[model samples]
Target chain A: MNKWEDNKAWFLILPVFIIVAFSAVIPLMTVVNYSVQDIFGPGQRFFIGIEWFKEVLSDGRLHEALWRQLLFSGLVLLIEMPLGIGIALLMPKKGWGSSACLVILALPLLIPWNVIGTIWIIFTRPDIGLFGAAINTLGLPFDHTASPFDAWVTVMLMEVWHWTPLVALLAYAGLRAIPEVYYQAAKIDGASSWAIFRYIQLPKMRGVLTIALLLRFMDSFLIYAEPFVLTGGGPGNSTTFLSIYLVKVAVGQFDLGPAAAFSLIYFLIVLLFCWLFYQALQAVGTGDKQ
Target chain B: MARIDLNEIRHSYKPSPKSDDDFALKRVHTTWEDGGAYALLGPSGCGKTTMLNIISGLLKPSHGQILYDGVDVSAMQPEERNIAQVFQFPVLYDTMTVYDNLAFPLRNRNVPASEVDARVRRIAETLELTNDLGKRAAGLSADAKQKISLGRGLVRSDVAAILFDEPLTVIDPHLKWELRRKLKEIHKEFGLTMIYVTHDQVEAMTFADKIVVMYEGEIVQTGTPEELFERPEHVFVGYFIGSPGMGFLECTLEGDIAHVNGAAIPLEPGYGVRASSLGSRFKLGIRPMYLGVHSSREACGELPGFEARVVGVEDQGFCRIVTVQFGGQEIKARINDGHPVAEGLCWLTFPPEKTKLYFNERLVG
Candidate 1:
């Protein structure tokens, strides 16, 4: 009676395997094939062993962009996490007010990425837009099109506004999942507001916060559309992230071998960091036994 | 160490209650003395939990005052009231150690670290949680988590009261008995005024010095367990506090004689005036244990006897419950273990003084 008799379960997973093999595996193999070959034309090629890998690894431009990418992602996580939690806490808990607040707060996330960039471009025009004019009226020179610092600040502001809502929505869901008895018990025990937030609310939100961190990291690492539309790699490549630099190498210069090699390295870097983050989060969440 | 007085308390879930049905709790005026253990017993949705919450300052009564030691605290916050409560489900900080969980209340009040440590350890030792003090609270089982929840309440020496809201519903049955005994011992040792809320009659009877019986959001009786079982003020109290409960029969009383289906049983002469004023709704309640079964020839025949048909007999080891039909109704009779289950015709007698006459569900004088 204990012997396994169900072969039908295997058929249910076959579609997922086929789709992944075609979409991810096959294209990955093609990149691997291109990275190892020195192609002169469509039909002419020569086997080059690890030449492109070593050359791409030594490139100075890639190193600068990688460092810039790390800084941008780090800064994005730092600003968005706490801001999102604060917004979630401020939202109403019940009645029609809660629904109205949710609808208004979710408006920014629904806007397309390129549209967000376009909106910010017109919204900070210095002479015509309110944001730039207000800052200039305060006697501060604020033109995003000219200075590198101004350009970086505008881009950071746009990014924070565009994605903070996602983190806030996730945290709101986490807060709602806690039982009401915890708060009642905490109140009767004479716990202050800060202690309740630190112990009860924050610890309960760890699972969703982990998701928010991973999502914002992976999305910001691979960011392309918003910054591209806003800065266009800048007057001196001041705001050029890794993807922008990679696009310049792959499509602008069309150096097929080194570009393919760089693409594989970039993919591996993101994958390795994501794996490490998952491990660290799981370790903290599970905690330690006595 | 406080005497709690609730004066004319009424609560309604609606903004303006049109009738008594909208009120979750009717007007309740009662006092719990210092160092006394009391149980508020009722069925679900009977406002027992609402009463406990109002007393602990988690809720404020709509139109009344709560006084502790002659000081009005109805408008005060829960923290200002200096009370502790244990919920039905265990509520513990999942990341803290058991010792930290016990010390949470004291630490929040800015107790020194040394004193917090001493009190936490002392309570832990008393609750048999010393071995698990260093372990994560989240890693313990449900019963252990509940123990830590209770220990948090006991760590504070100056607390006015500790209220428990069905703290043992999630525990194993055998452990529930063990924890109940431990609670009794703690009550004796510390003399803390404790109020417990539960739906189980046995739990209320075993753990409380006084039992407050509530039904349909009304306080029906407040008495000792023996008083509640013997002289139940309302029909609900008699049915709610016993194993099989008292059996009630519809009857018409005219001049001290209660006529049940065609046979008449005499009651005390004082009931004659009250029974004449009663409407058509009247009943006579008698406990199952008082109803005796006898053969026709063996009775001395002073009491009223009726030929009853045996419907069913349930043998409950030490005792047996005999279900019979008489006077157009069914009543349960408890007999000794070896009592023969006689089928067909059997004479059933209800002793005169043990029988109680009810007018509008209230016992008569």
Candidate 2:
């Protein structure tokens, strides 16, 4: 008999498969089913074919939300990656202070997304919040409630504060993995500090930085709660992300047909981008390996 | 070429060295001739590596100065000192090809393309890495990567001295011999000053023209390989430089004879009196290769010789090592394979001419 002829071994994975099928596949099928039909109310439905998809494609709202989401994700990555790397570089290599710094950095990451948004919302109130009071005291008009530009800036700052630590922590782990021998060798080679950083530290961190970039891009593109709590999809929707917009369509308006269609489109877009990222990362990794 | 001078160099990591116990490295004053091969040999945690790093300008001395051809270079950076260092493990750029790894330092110095290619190709040939030059370093095995590291160091001829910190530890056993021979050949061809640090006695003995034996941060003895083997200045040196090491037994100095466990043993002339000024703790040191076995009737003098009980025997192809208990102490004796010896009681003798005496851990004669 073949060595792997024992089919009973698959029983071990049955529970996991069942859980994923119910939680992921079943829900996905329900959404697909809803996308093909128009639901007027509970128990009232009609086949709509691809009409909802066409409508969503030409909506123009999606185009605007996509543009905004892209800009937001780009801005978050640009600001967070370098700032995170810089903070990690400045951290002590080892000691009690390292543990202390780690705890302090992890605190923000552990906070619930909604709670973070609520905290920022209360903290940016011009009337009562310390930051808002300080800004107002400086004789500058800074109200995220009424100004679109202020709302955008507030949302961006809130995201940076809440997520920069994740990038920093990952970068720190990458940096720490590099052995001291490389640095010693570089020193003997007469490498300048800039050369050492550019050649050694940067190349060594490529793996971790790629992961950080992909994660930050996906999270920022789909950001909902923080911006929602801070501006409630913004002062005139200036800070509205794709996720919040989708939630509004699915729950607020209760248009299950259009909402399911919109969600499928959203999922496809994310999947496409993730696939692109994975390909790019594989290219870089294999190129280096060669 | 430069004659490096280390003038009264001392270092202690502690803030205050209240007594001799606090000094990580005691005061060491030495000089190296221009274009010489030196090996710093000692056990782990001995200050051999520390001294090498100091010479390479990685560590500043707590006191004194390092001078290269009469120019003070104590405060200089390693790059400024013009030294090439090979680490214990390979430290090549994993993202770069083997050729690119060798080309890095040359590019940093802005060397012309033709010269860089010629030099890199030459060192690659010496290291026997010509075929794999185009391959990425990450795909290569550990030994190949280390060979690349060695090539990177040797490619630059302008460096004042090349320092190797146990560079062959990652190499294969068979490759280590070939690499050491190649390094010896390269040193002969280039005539560059080389300082090799290793705890392995064989590598140091074969590679260095002058072996500097360090113990507890002090240069116990610095001499030619022959001098180190024939006459070790410190007990640690005698113990460290030989395979199976030198066997030492605690003894007392009584005039010209050394007494161990009430057994009188003859010593080389001018042995005990020479160390009389040094302190009380005395011991007799002898290499196993020199310690011989003799039948009771074959003995020549009344000088103490032990009828030792044979504990074990090791056949080392060319010779046999017999572990024997003499005067309540276990000692190893190297005998020719042809010698008739058994696993019972055997008479052992310490030849006076081959014996060394130590007083307070310092060699007497």
The candidate that wins on DockQ is 1
Q: Tell me the TM-score of each prediction against the true structure.
A: 0.96, 0.91
Give every collision pair in model 1. none
Worst 10 residues of 1 chain A by lDDT: A281-290
Off by over 4 Å in 2: A1-8, A41-51, A94-104, A122-143, A288-290, B15-22, B278-281, B299-307
As for candidate 2, its clashing pairs are none
Each prediction's DockQ against the real complex: 0.68, 0.50
Query: lDDT winner among the candidates?
Result: 1
lDDT of 2 by residue, A1-290 (tens): 55757789799999999999999999999999999999878788899899888888787877788889888988998999999999889899999989999999999999999999899888889999888878989998899999999898889889999999999999999999999889988888777788788878888998998899889988988898888888888787787789988898889988788889999999898889888887887666447433
Q: Name the DockQ score for candidate 1.
A: 0.68
Worst 10 residues of 2 chain A by lDDT: A281-290
| Candidate 2, chain B, TM-score (2 decimals) | 0.93
